[model samples]
Target: MAAIATDTHPYGRVSRLFHWGMAALFAWQFVTVGARVLLPDGALDDFLWPTHKPLGALLMLLVVLRLVWALVDRTRRPPSLNLAAHLGHLALYALMVAVPLVALMRQYGSGRAFSPFGIPLMSGFEGEIEWMTAIGGIFHGLLGWVLLALVVGHVGMAILHRRLSDENVLARMAPHAGQSR
Candidate 1:
């Protein structure tokens, strides 16, 4: 159907799929982090902590695919709500890529094998690399928190734009809904 592939109207099926699917995954990722933080060394932490890395790896892969899809669909997609929205999206993309990348670098530096979803990503080494681990240690949690804040802001702005300006910002991506463009 035409609606399945054109964001100039409503967002295309593929784009919506990527957006909402990633949103759910990101939500789960944050839940895992929250559990780890709030219930440290407890049963909840034990259960959620293990899912974090594997889910993060999965998210990394999906983000890459989504970015490529975005580029390919650039002309077909609706324009951003404003300059701030454009820049906010860019920041989201950057942090999405950077967070997992640094975590993987740290994994490599730890001289440990990483096999997310049972696929061998890295082979364990004999010794650790200090600088890589240091960078990961310093930035991973900090940037993750920052990313969370940005995500919250993003959601808030979407709602605010819709409520205060009657922009229908949220509807643009929803099924059979309004298009700002």
Candidate 2:
């Protein structure tokens, strides 16, 4: 059998790079969140918590890029293995976009300045918008936790697919050369 081209096989290099890169970032984000929740007021929480918003903002950008790339490469990229996988991916994308956006909304509504990576995204104002802040305060963290759960389920399903199915789904996303489908 011939080896599938990167664009036509599992995922292109760019796709994999986005996937793994965002995975690492999400891991860091979770660590920061966990520390904030479990070790509040401690040095670890203080250290990691500060990165949460900035990192979330970064993830939001990356996810948008990834979505665009996926669309551009859709014809060449590997097909979804099943309906479940397709729906799961859609949910992931939805949550990924929503989590950061709501947080940003809250930040803006709070009338607080936010500069992620030293770029001024929001300027502080005198009065807070109660509804925007309330919506974000309610959903941001809750949706974030939901996203994390979905991620865990995603990984679990991938493992199950690899172990039980005839096809090795992992090969599509795994870092390897000359993969075939």
Per-model TM-score on C-alpha atoms: 0.91, 0.92
List candidate 2 segments past 4 Å from native: 1-8, 175-181
Q: Write the per-residue lDDT of candidate 2 for residues 1-181, one digit (tens) a residue.
A: 3433322367778999999999999999999999989999999998899899999999989999999999998897888878989899999999999999999999999999999999998889999999999999999999999999999999998766656655566777883533434
Clashing pairs in 1: none
What overall lDDT goes with each candidate model?
Answer: 0.84, 0.87
Candidate 1 TM-score, C-alpha based: 0.91
- Candidate 1: residue 24 Cα off by (Å): 0.9
- 121-165, model 1: which lDDT tens digit per residue? 999989999999999999988889988999999999876665566
